[model samples]
Target: MAQQRDTAEADRTLKAKHRAIWASGDYPSVAAEIIPGLGALLVEACGVKAGDRVLDVAAGTGNAAIPAALAGADVVACDLTPELLEAGRLMADRSGVDLRWREADAEALPFADADFDTVLSCVGVMFAPHHQAAADELVRVCRPGGTIGLLSWTPEGFLGQLLTALKPYAPPPPPGARPAPLWGDPDHVRALLGDRVTDVSAERRTVLVDRFETPEGFRDYFKERYGPVLAVYRAHAEDPERLAALDRDLAELARRHDRAAGSGPTVMEWEYLLLTAHRTDTSP
Candidate 1:
C-alpha cells in the first residue's frame, strides 16, 4: 500500500511538471502560427463527419478539436493543462463552434468506456509520458467500429531531427516517459494498438513549413514561444555558453533540412505519420 501511494504521488508530480512546462511557454502562438493546418488534416483523415461524437486527446489549444467541431462533429477537447483548454474553448467560441473542453490526462482519460465515435490526436498524445497507457485509453474510450486517428512527427522527419538536435542539451527525460517521436513509427503504433483495432491504414504525409526565412530565425522563434524548447532554454538560463551551443545546433539542423530555393523563403517539409484504424473491441 505504501509503494502504491508513492507511485501515485510520483505520477502526480510528473504530471504537474508537464502542465507547468506547457503553460510556461506561448504554445498558443506556436500552434496558431506554425502548424495550424495539421489539425484540419487530421480531422479530414479521421473522417469526422457531422453528428459524430469525437474526443481529441491531449489536445493542445484545440488544434484538432476546434477543426473537428467546425466540421459539425460533437467534439470534446481534453488535455493535461487547463490553460490550453481554456484557450481552445475561447477560440472555439470565437469561431462559432461548440465543443467541450476538459482537463484530462491522456494516459488516464476521464471519459466512460466506448463513449466516442471517433478518437484522435494530432501531434498531441505523442507527448504522453506513458505511451501504452495513452494508447490503451484511446482504444478503451472509442466505440467498436469507431476510428482511431493519430498524426505524429516521423522519426526521420524535420521535427524528429529538431528533437534529436535538442536532446544533447535538454534535461534527461523523466522516468517512464518515452520519446514522443516513436509514435511516428508505424510498427510502434501497431504494436501499441495491437489486436484491439482493425483495418489499419498508415500514410506518410508532409506539411510545408515556411515560417522563417533563416534557420536562426526559426530557432529564435522556438526558443521564445514553443513549450518544450522554452523549458530547455530556461534550464540553461544561467549558462550562456550551453544555450549558445544549443542555438547553434538547432540552427544547423534547420539549415540542413531547409529546401528553399534562392533563399526566397525557407521551405521545409515536416514528415508525419497518419495512422487510422477501426476499433474492433475492448479486449486487451
Candidate 2:
C-alpha cells in the first residue's frame, strides 16, 4: 500500500513536467508535423491496406490513428490517459475520420485474441510498466501473420538533447526515469518480444522538428497543455526558489527563440526506429 502511494507520487511529479512541457500548443503541433511521415512509414512498413482492422495503442491526439483511418483502416485508438484520448477523439471528429476511441492501458489491453489485422503504436510501448507484457498484449490481439507496427524515439536523439538541456533547470526526475524507452532498439525489443514473434524488423528514420518558436516556447507550451504533469508539479516540489529558477531559465529560452527569428527553423532533429513484426499463432 505504501509502495503504491510512493509510485503514484513519483508518477505525478513526472506528469506535471509533461503538462508544462506540452502546454504551448506544441503537443498538437509536433504531432501534426510528424504524423505524415509516421503515417507513410506505418503504411509502407506494415503494408496496411484499406479496410484493415487496426489497433492504435497510445494514440496520442490521433496523430497516427487519424492518418491510418484516412487510409481507410478501421482503427481502434486506445490510451491510458483519458484526457489525451478525449483530445484525440475531438481531433478525429474534426478531421471527419471514424476512429473508435477507448480508454485502456497498453500493458493490459481489453480485446479478444486475434481481433486485429494490424496493431500500431507511436512511441508508446515503452511507457508501460511491464514492457514484456505490453508487447505480448499487442501481439496477442493481432491475427497470425498480421503486422504490428511501431515508432520509438531514440533516447540519444535531439528529443533527448532537449530534455537534457531542461534537466539542469527543472527539479530532478526519479531515478532510472526516461521520457520513454525505445523498444525498437534491436537487442532490447527482441529480448522483450522473445521467440514467439516472427520476422521482426526495425528501421531508423530522422524526424524534423519545427514549431518550437524557441526553447522558452517549448517550456511554456508544455506547462499549460499537459494536465497530469501540471497537477504533479503543483502537488510536489514545494520549493519556491526552484520554481523561480525555472521561470528565469525558461525566460532565457524565450529570448533565444525571439533572437532566432527571421533566420530559419531551430532545426531540432529526432531519430526514430520503426519496427514491424508478424504475430505467430500459438496454437499447435
- The best candidate by TM-score is 1
**Over the full model, what C-alpha lDDT does candidate 2 score relative to the true structure?**
0.68
Off by more than 4 A, model 1 = none
Each prediction's whole-model lDDT (CA): 0.91, 0.68
C-alpha root-mean-square deviation, candidate 1: 1.2
Instruction: Kindly report which residue pairs in candidate 1 clash with one another.
Output: none
> Against the true structure, whose lDDT is highest?
1
Tens-place lDDT per residue, model 1, 149-263, is 9999999999888877778887788778899999999999999999999999999999989979788888999988888888889989999999989888988888888897437
Over 71-150, each residue of candidate 2 has an lDDT whose tens digit, in order, gives 89999988776667777888888889897999776767899989999999886665654567677888888998888888
What's the CA RMSD of model 2 in angstroms?
4.9
